[model samples]
Target: MTKKYAIIDTGGKQLRVEPGRFYDIHPFTSMGLNFLKPNTKISLCRVLLICEGSNINLGHPWIRNAIVRGRVLHPCFDKKKIIAKIDSKHKTRKELGYRQNLIRFIVDSIWSNGKELVS
Candidate 1:
């Protein structure tokens, strides 16, 4: 299996990820209300770094030969979240709730240096 690196953009954030590794991505809803489905395939167009074995290539805007592939595992929310409000003098208190949509992806491959990793 060939080894390579790829850069991907998720939820307006760019990430450098690899295969066999898992990463947290922003909720699909963040993209737009149109994207509310779970476990959907979304292409990440931002390529930043591609490292293959010993050869490494970097993108000016994006590496010409780098491509990263990933799969959306599931749609969920963070385990721990907190929202609170308080007023000291008035002794008033309020609390808010939050549960953000999150996606877990498994890096399928990082194509760079004219090579691709086996899935």
Candidate 2:
């Protein structure tokens, strides 16, 4: 069987996603995925490209009926990043830390034109 994958636009980023795999993405309000409980079913419709077997479908912007179905695994925070600054002349020091909110999900399948491309 040919391995299938797709390029999807979400959370202001393009990601290559495959079925039955887990992926982490920044939480975005536009997708209305924030605050979702675990195991919640979701369908992402902004597929930019899809490849199945030897057939590839490239959308001008987005395929008319192409959608990727998945379920939310859970919500989590990414690794913390620390930032530090120091000024000798000013005799000042500062430090900051940040952790981005992220959501993990498993891609169950990819579909295009009413056909299941990947399972």
Per-model TM values vs. the true structure: 0.73, 0.90
- Cα lDDT of model 1 by residue, 1-119, tens digit: 66555666667788878777878877654465346455556555567766667767777877676667667776667765677899999999998888776777777767665677554
Worst 10 residues of 1 by lDDT: 29-38
Q: Candidate 2 lDDT, tens digit per residue, 3-102?
A: 8999999988999999989999877685555558799888999999998778788998988899999999999889999999999999999999999889
Instruction: List CA RMSD, all candidates.
Output: 3.3, 1.7
- Cα lDDT, all candidates: 0.69, 0.88
Measured by TM-score, the strongest candidate is 2
Clashes (candidate 2):
0
User: Which one is best on lDDT?
Assistant: 2
lDDT of candidate model 2 versus the reference: 0.88
